[model samples]
Target chain A: MRRLINRHPSRRMKILLGALPFILAVAIYAIAADARGADGPDKLMPGLNAITSAMSRLMFDIDRATGARLFWADTWASLARLGVGLGISAVIGLGLGVPVGFIPCLRALFEPFFAALSLIPPLAVLPILFILFGLGELSKTVLIVFGIAPFILRDVMLRVAEIPREQIVKAQTLGASSWQMILGLVLPQVFARLISSVRLSLGAAWLFVIAAEAITAEAGLGYRIFLVRRYLAMDVILPYVLWITLLAFAMDYALRQAHDAIPWTRFKEGG
Target chain B: MMAVIRLDNVSKSYGETVVLENVSLTIEDNEFLAVVGPSGAGKTTLLRMLLSQEAPSSGRILIDDAPIAAEPMPDRGVVFQRYSVLPHRTVIRNVMTGPEWLAAPFTGRVMGRARAALKSRARNMLDRVGLGDHATLYPAQLSGGQQQRLAIAQALMMNPKVLLLDEPFGALDPATRRAMHRLVLGLWAEHKMTVVMITHDLSEAFHLGTRVVAVEKRRHDPHAPHRYGSVITTDFDAKPRLARQIARAPA
Candidate 1:
C-alpha cells in the first residue's frame, strides 16, 4: 500500500473525494436544522425545504410591487453593469497601455503615474464616485471601471513590454511603420492578454459592483442580499449567495475557454 | 565582384565600454560572409551594424556606396536564434507579413486580389522552406527546426538584398543544424542575396560562408577588459574550398 502522501486518487475516486465535503456540509446543515426544530418563529439556520421554496418563489413568481421576476431582473441589471464597465475598461486598457508600453516617451511619462493610480484602493473612491456621478447606475458602473481598469492597463502594458525585442526588430525589418507595428504586431498580442487580465479582475469587479449596489441601489444581487438581511431571511440570502458564486464560476470558466481558444497563449516565449 | 556592403573603420562604444573598435570590412555582392567569435566578442554587434539595428559610434556603414538607414528596413531581413517569427501568426501569415507591410504600409494588410497574390507567393515561399503543409499552424505548434524554416521563409518573402542571420541554428540539435545548413546554402545560391551570418561554430562558418571572418580582441588589458574592443582578427577565403567540396559532393 502506498503512503497517504504518495497515494493518488483515480478519476472516479477524485470526483468522490471532491464531492465529500459538500455532501458532509449539507448533511451537517440538515442535522442542525432538525435539532433547531422545523417549526420556528426565529430560526437562524433555515431548512433545505425553506431555502428551495424561497428560491422557487424568486425564480417562478412575480413580485407584487414591480410585477417582474426579481431574481432574473437583478441578474440582468448586474450583468449589464458588469459588461459595460468591463467593455469600457478593455478599450481604455488597449488604447493607453499599448502606446505606453511601446513608446519610450509615453512609458516614461505615464508609467509611474499609472502605477501609482493602480495602487489606490478602488473601494476608497466609492463615495467620491457617488458624490461625483450620483447614486444612479453610472456610479456603480464607474466604480467597477475605476476598480479594475488600472489593473488591466498595467497587465497589458507589462505584456506588451514582455514581447520579445527580436519580434519588434523583425517587424521593423519587414517595413512595419510605428502605427503598423502597434496595430498589426502589438495590438493582437495585447488584446489576447486583455481577456486574461479581465478574467483575473472579475472578482474585484464583482466586489465593487456589489459594494456600490449594497450602498445604494433599487435592484441587483447585492441590493437584494442587503435588503432582506434585516429580517434574518437566511433562506433567500443563502440561495442568492450560491447563485452569485455559480455566476462567477461560470464567467471564470468561460474566460478560461476563450483564452485557450487563441491556440498560442498556452506556449511560452520563443516558441 | 562589386562590394555590396562596406564598413569603414567602424567603432561602437557605450560610454566607457567598447564592443567593436575600428573594424573595417567589405562584403561583395552575393557573398556569404560568416562571422565567428567567442561570447562578448561583438560578432552579433557587427551583424546588427550591417542590418542597421545598431549605429557605429565613429565610422560609417555603406550599402551600395550609400550610408545605411538608421533603422532596419525591408532592404535587409534578419533571422535570430529565437523569436524571429511572430508566435501569434500562422506560418503562412508570417511569410506574407513583409509583402503585406510593403504593399500597405498603413494597414499592414492587402485586400482582395493583392492579398490573394501575396498568399500564393507566401505559399510558394513556405514550400521552398518545406513548411507548405503547416501553413495554418502557429509558431508555437512548430518544432525548433520548423520554426527556423518559417523564419527563413519570412525573411525571404521580403526579397532583401542582404540577409542577416544571428546564430540562427544555435538552438537546434546537430541533425537539424545540418539540414538547415543545406537549406540555407540552397537558398543563398538560388536567391543570390548578400549574406552575413554570425556563428560560434568555426566548422559551420567554413561550411556556409564564402568568406569566414573571426572577430576577437587583438590586444587585451587584464585590468581594463573594456578598454580593448574586438576587431576582425582573421579573414579567410573559403569560396574555393567550398566550391571544390560542392563539386565532389554534387548535392
Candidate 2:
C-alpha cells in the first residue's frame, strides 16, 4: 500500500488527516470507558452517553434550588467577572504603562515597585484579597485584576519603550508638544499592543477567576467543577473542563480575528 | 546674500569625550551646504545642533540671526538616514503628518477642507518626488529608495524654512541615489529653502552643494589622541573648487 505518511496529503486528504487524531482520541476514551464499565459500571471514567446526558441536564434543566439553568448561569457569571476584571486592567495597564514608559521621573518612581510586584505570584495574594475585600464579587474581580494588571502594564511599558529614537526625534521636529507626542504617537500604537498582551494574559485571568470562584462563589464554571468534585462524577467534570477549554479557545480566536481586522496592528502582532 | 543661520565658536563634549570643537560658520539664505567627514568626526553633531536635537556645550546657534530654541520645531524639517515616515500610515498620510501634526490631535483622522488641503499638498509633493502612484502604500511596502522619497515628501509638507538632511539618500542604490540627488536639488531650488546636509559622498557634496565644509580631528599627541575633537577643517565656496576638480579629472 502507498503510505500516506511519507507523501504530502492533498487538501481533501488533509482534512481527514486533521480529524484522524480527534477521532482516535474519542475512540480511545470510549474503549477505556467500556473496559471500566465492564467491571464496575458505576465508574470514574464516564462513557460517551453518560457525559452527553449529564451535559444536557446541566445545561437545559432548571436547578431546583435557584429556578435557573445552571450551566448558562455559571458561564455568564464567570464571563462577567473576567470581562470586568480585564476591562479595568486594560485601563490601568495603559494608564500606568504610558507615563512610566515616557516620563523619566515616573519611570524612576514606579518601575522598581511594579517590577517586584509582578514577581509575586498573584494567587499568593488571593487570601489576603479575600480577607481585605471579603468573600464577595469584589474579591473575585479584584483577584483577577491583581493577577493580570501587572503583566499587562509591564507589556505596555515595553511597547512604549520600543518606539524608536528616530521616530521620537521626527515627531518632536514636526512641532508636536510632549503631551501631543505621548497622546498622539504613543496612544495610537499602544492600544493594539494592549489587546495582544491581554490575550496572552487571558489564560492567567481564567486561572485567577476559577481559583477565586472555586474557593468561594455562588455560581461559576469553577464553582461547579469544585462542587461536583466530591462525588467523582467524571461525566459532569469532563464536560465542564471541555466547555471551559472551548470557551477560552473561542475567546483567543476572536481576539486574533479582531487584531487582524485592524490595519495598523502588524507591529503589535509581531512582538 | 543674507546669512540665514550662524554658529559661533561651537563645541560639544560628553564627559571626557569630545565630539566637536571650535566650529563656526555663517549659512546664507537658500544656500545648499553639504558637510562631509570621516566616521566619528562630528558632521552629524553639527546638524543635530541646528535641528535642536542637542545643544552645543559652548556657544550659540542662531537661525535667521535669532538663537535657536531649546526644542525642535517643524520650522526646520529633516530627513534622517533612516526612513522617518511612520510605518502604519499610507504614503499620503505619512507626507501629511506635519500639517496634520500641527493641527490634528492624535486621532489619526482628518476631515473637511483642512484634510483636503493637506492631502492635496502631500499628493503634489509625492508626485514631485516620483511617488505619485504610491500614495496608498505603507512604508514597508516601498523599496529603500521609494521610502527615502516618501521621507523627503513628508519633511517638505511642512514647508520648512530650513531643511536638514542627515545622509538621507545613503541607503539607496547608486541609480536611486542619482534620482534622489536630482529630486532633492529640484526641491531645494524650487522652494529656495536653506539646505544643511551631512554626507560621506564627496561627489554628492560637490554636485548639490554651493558650499562644502569638511570636519576632521586635529592632530594630537599620540598619548592624548582623545584630547582634541573634530573641527570645521575646510569651509569654502564649492562651485569654483568643484569646477577645478571636475576639469582636472582624467577621462
Query: What TM-score does chain A reach in every model?
Result: 0.94, 0.92
TM-score of chain B of 1: 0.94
Docking class of 1: medium
Cα TM-score of candidate 1: 0.94
Q: What is the C-alpha lDDT of each candidate?
A: 0.90, 0.86
The most accurate candidate by lDDT is: 1
User: What's the true lDDT of residue A175 in model 2?
Assistant: 72
Weakest 10 consecutive residues of candidate 2 chain B by summed lDDT: B241-250
Give per-residue CA lDDT, model 1, range A220-256, as digits (tens): 9999999999988998998888889899999999999
TM-score of chain A of 2: 0.92
Candidate 1 lDDT, B1-251, residue by residue in tens: 23399999999998899999999998888888999999999998888888777888999999899998999998899999999998888889999998888889778889999989889999898989899999998898899999999999999888889999999999999999999999999998778789999999999999899899999999999999899899889999998745645764635
Interface RMSD of each: 1.4, 4.0
Each candidate's B-chain TM-score, in sequence, is 0.94, 0.92
Per-residue error (Å), model 1, residue A73: 1.7
Candidate 1: residue A190 Cα off by (Å): 1.6
